[model samples]
Target: MSALPDSRYVSLTTFRRSGVAVPTPVWAAPDGGDLVVWTRADSGKVKRLRHTSRVTVAPCDVRGNLQGEAVEAQARLLPPGEWQPALAALARRYGWQWRITYGAGRLVGILRRRERRALIRISPA
Candidate 1:
């Protein structure tokens, strides 16, 4: 499935145990038949994905506001071997802006001793 447009900011909604959804806006890029995204490892989305693959995604603006209807999807954390490649794909799709922002995010993560961010792949459910 085409998971939004290649360079769209998608609102990724991950579910809580009680079935409530928590949404966050994220930059995503097409990765073969799936979509790839990178986010802080400790984020709520990652935590929820660990518990369940159930997720919904939709085109959105930078503030997590939805601009389209959500579609069902499943997400998985990608293997470490693919992290760099996934990031490269994102850069190719988003250009220098992504390169700068992603690079800086990594730098800040290191400086803050934060958990390293994770790369995820999302596919149609």
Candidate 2:
């Protein structure tokens, strides 16, 4: 298979106990030669990720049209601090509103409650 895009919003698919949950339009960052994603710690995605680390991330166009190779990678939960900087950088690059929110710990808490970020180490699978 061909290589995936370096950085872009991707549709992340994870398996939940109830069924499969597909979270679309998630921001992913290329860090330490891997792709990382952040989500609520208590999110169903997190729960699903715990059971299976394998995941698929695909790129989408302006109209939310998917294209390119869907990356298959191994996922692992990252400590909050471990991925915060990268996440912040991505937010700034994408003009997201999280940078200002990070200044306030309470706001961060409110925003990230039950949210656990994960790093997906991409490689030929």
Candidate 3:
């Protein structure tokens, strides 16, 4: 694995076609040989990954303050059918915190009549 720290949040940076980097903090958990992250399917990071897998990851706080050295990585958006494993990994790492977040998101989606989740797998580059 890369030197990604075991922090509560990771600063996931993605690039735009113009080469500008956008960073966001997200919860991440190790799954097999990759790090899995949960996000909304329509999130900007997911959209960026579709355009290019190139990315950088660094341990950070929830506010996106980098707390460790950044590492180059490749990110892949997992198909919907493959989301379970990623969710499981997150749940294991976060426990009740994740459950509450998951439940709240599900409830909101049901009320809004649309729910789409994305799973991203980050591998060393």
Candidate 4:
């Protein structure tokens, strides 16, 4: 497994059923040297992830440009309360408006893990 990223944001790319790339913003956490992300159980992202555990999570600059090797890793949907603090921290940091939507159903803490991927390259600003 590769080292966890050092940035707050990661570009999460999942493969669609049509075999197309679907990228989105995902909050990440370094758990026991592994990368973790939270999403709703019924979310499209989660559904796609279930199909393709292979995914990329990379650090980016303020402009949303890739900064380093988007680490490639496997993703797993974690059950609620598995990682509460991490999930809460992400909500506070991102100011997620849908926190209650997930929290209300007690569907919080659905974490995805990224195992390893090639380092992405980014030019110095």
Predictions in order: lDDT? 0.85, 0.60, 0.89, 0.59
Model 3, residue 123: C-alpha shift (Å): 0.8
Any idea what lDDT model 2 has? Answer: 0.60
For candidate 1, the per-residue lDDT at 22 reads 91
How do the candidates rank by TM-score, highest first?
3, 1, 2, 4
**Mind giving the per-residue lDDT tens digits that candidate 1 earns over 16-90?**
999998988998988777789988888888899999999888988999777888889999999888787788889
Could you give me the TM-score of model 4 versus the true structure? Answer: 0.61
Q: List CA RMSD, all candidates.
A: 2.0, 3.9, 1.4, 9.1
Q: Please, what is the TM-score per model?
A: 0.87, 0.67, 0.92, 0.61
> What's the lDDT for candidate 4?
0.59
Give the per-residue lDDT digits (tens) of candidate 3, residues 21-81. 9999999998887789989889999999999999999999989999889999999988879
Q: Could you say which candidate leads in lDDT?
A: 3
lDDT of 4 by residue, 1-125 (tens): 56656677777777888888877775564544565666545667777867767677778755557778876766766544465655555465556553664454353233334322111221111
Candidate 2 all-Cα RMSD? 3.9
**Reference-based TM-score, model 1:** 0.87
Provide the global lDDT of candidate 1 against the true structure. Answer: 0.85
Per-residue C-alpha lDDT of model 2 across residues 46-97, encoded as one tens digit per residue: 7777887767767866444677667776677776557666665566655645
